[model samples]
Target: MSAVASETKTRQLPYVVAITEGVREVLKEQANAFVAGEDVAGAGSVYGYYRGLLDEFGADRIYDTPISEKGIIGLGVGAAAAGLRPVLDIMFMDFIGECMDEIANQMAKMRFMFGGSATLPITVLTMAGAGANLAAQHSQSLEAWLAHLPGLKVVMPATPYDAKGLIIAAARDDNPVFVVLNKMSLAMMGDVPEGPYEVPIGKANVVRTGKNYTIVTLGRMLGQALDAAKQLAELGIDAEVIDARSVQPFDTEAVIKSVEKTHRAMVVHEAVRFGGFGAEIAAQIQEHAFDYLDAPVARVGAPFSPVPFSPALEKVYVPNAERIVVVAREQLGI
Candidate 1:
């Protein structure tokens, strides 16, 4: 027998970079996979995540539609119903309200109404949260609203690796998938493997392990929660960090397990405290892990007010690492 050699490759990049690479790969792999939205083709999306896609895929594949959110969503729904995997961008997640009827009534319910005969593989990518001081409308985290709906998948990627993998998975899934990418995570750098990869929707990732308390977070909050865990460590609190990557599917098993070990939990998010996604996580933890819990589940989120435009006020509006640390201490009775 002769010895054989195996090759290995490695690369590090940001979430936006990984997303760009995934979009390119999807465009290359599937002829049916098309991109559409305002400024998506020529402008490469508002955040420049889709930069050069128009040039590479051509105008036919990467299209720039008119500034009509409802029209863009309707087109995506129709195209998906007719057998095209269309990736539509609505720029900001808050703007999804503009096309609620199209997304909720048509795209989400079509398959079930048709007796499961149709497969609407539509992926809508949008930005959310309040960190860049983009004002009220642009900074809302409305994932909780979408997660409440049926026949739809909601994903929030916390890292560059998850961003690429989840997008690919969303493209391949039969249901309509809404990917809420955080603006802050766009430029965040991390390790990402090459080639096509898919992170199955409805799964949660435990980013950090500990035993004192569990902090369940999603999207941009995951970073802050991890940082908070680091600070808590110095204070003799080993906080576990769970990234609820998929809001709709929501990994209750992982969450319950974490709560079982820690016996304490603190749910955090950038969304408002009232009726936000954190509420649902808290409720679920209470339902399943109530017996294991030593204290009531705590939630840390923004106030019930619009995101401010002033940079100074915006800093106070969004949840940060220090806030998480403070909340964790209270929940742990430290």
Candidate 2:
């Protein structure tokens, strides 16, 4: 089901504010839910999304932990296993390396290893993407790492609406859910409904409907894909755009269906091209709709290198609509 609401009572909220509101509503609804992470309680997080949450939820519910990703994630795993819903914040997604053991082995496999007896209802909120010039260590899109895990659900919400809805949905889930948010989109604004709402995980949204060609996008790349669609339309190519909101339980059906109609498809993402999630999407499209494909499935992503610190290089390093349009044209022979 599409997560977007068509109600006329919606109001514009920045991507960061929507996230804060989502967490607020989750804490309000789930009595057992609590949020803990570095600088989240005292400084309201590095991105300022958690601003004012500590005062609203109190210290017990909103905790300030030491600068340790392993300890923070470990706390969530233990807390969730003990019946409390914990929202753990990993300040930068690149730091997932420091706590790989906790995530890959413990938090992700506790349920199955225990024969389904233990439940790790852990919701990890981490910042991703590379437009803020946070350098290599601080900026990265590592959703593929979590998505590859067996017992984890990975979600990348592009807009303010999905950011809010997905957060609430992740909090209420019974398994580990990673909400990979884009740091560059924090100031982006969109319509969001008041109160709590859930955007179902593992669902894809057809943001733009077209014929001729299909453009499947992940996370922040949705906007670029849409822009490329418009530019392609001007050049007599109607491109259908599908947002792969969830990466692990990817919405293969939506993409395959679009490819069947369009006969050509391309996957786009902010992560590096090699060994990126877009490769997985491209493979799925070919495997499911190979007979109907007019051309090989194409992929557009950042180069396989660390996110540059130089603003000039970083601007070129990130994938944009022009790149997508060029790739689509080359693949489509238009």
Candidate 3:
């Protein structure tokens, strides 16, 4: 069993359901918290994670807005600034382009621009990743964009547990937080604790322990990395797998500690390899654990092309366990 699946006692739930529960719990906990986005209430979200939320919370708390991404985010920024905790939905991660000004300039820099006098306790949830053939426009893992901005917390949850926990944690945080979710993993199931719980932002989870190598993965790549670890184990390689749940306030200590022990590290993500967050992680590893490294840190990610619409092309576009194994062997020379 995988490290996450090995845990017992917690009930199993789909990643999509966990998100619903997380948002529901957040609204229940925070009286001022409200959910706003296009088709979120009536459509129960384009992914069904927000299903039944309208019936449960009513329109006062759950709102369905127009199809304007900028307006949706603008409303969220204004509402959050006015002392209400808003859980805004940016239907698709790619839609962030429409609201970059609200996100980058207003939501991200407002608190700092005001010298900590203002707090934007906003949680922006958006779907990312390339699978289910959503194509380039709809299926881009753009977490790097949000992570690059200052004063914004970026988190990518790979499993159902992290999805629910991270969402709740993001909602509770005082600063603006982006819960970058994977649309392809919505149907994936995992053990999740019941009720409101936090997975804590800025912390990395070492899912699989090994002595030889460390494979730090972000978002949906956690499963692929674990699969690759299993494949490597068959060939006399023990690989430690770390889930980088949060990227901006990255858990450098966890990754550095792992690299210090294993003396070899690689970072992987679904974003474009040219300037993905993997580059940032690889750089951090070299800086913090240069003496411990036995080889240059490796990175695995997609090509710098747009996500393909065809299933055949997408299968080749997105990085998989085979690609990870190939890169690992080339880097480790084994």
Q: Evaluated with lDDT, which candidate comes out highest?
A: 3
Candidate 2 stretches with Cα past 4 Å from truth are 1-8
The 10 consecutive residues of candidate 1 with the worst lDDT sum are 1-10
User: Between 2 and 3, whose TM-score is larger?
Assistant: 2
lDDT by residue for model 2 over 206-299, one digit each (tens)?
9999988899989999999999999999999999999999997899999999999999999999998999998888888878898999899899
Off by over 4 Å in 1: 1-8
TM-score of each: 0.96, 0.97, 0.97
In terms of TM-score, the best-performing candidate is: 2
Per-residue lDDT of model 3, residues 225-320, tens digit only: 999999999988899999999998999999999999999998999999989999999999989899999999999999989999999999999999
Cα lDDT of candidate 2 equals 0.92
Report backbone clashes per prediction. 0, 0, 0
Candidate 1 lDDT over 1-334, as tens digits, reads 0111234233789999988977887888889999999899888988898999888888899989998999999999999888899999999998988999998888888999999998999999989978887899999999988998899999998888888888888898888999999988888998777777788899898889998789999788999999999999999989899999999989999999999999989999999989998888999999998899899988999999999999999998999999988877776767
Predicted structure 2, TM vs. truth: 0.97
Query: What would the TM-score be for candidate 3 when compared with the true structure?
Result: 0.97
Q: Is candidate 1 or candidate 3 better by TM-score?
A: 3
Candidate 3 residue pairs in backbone clash: none
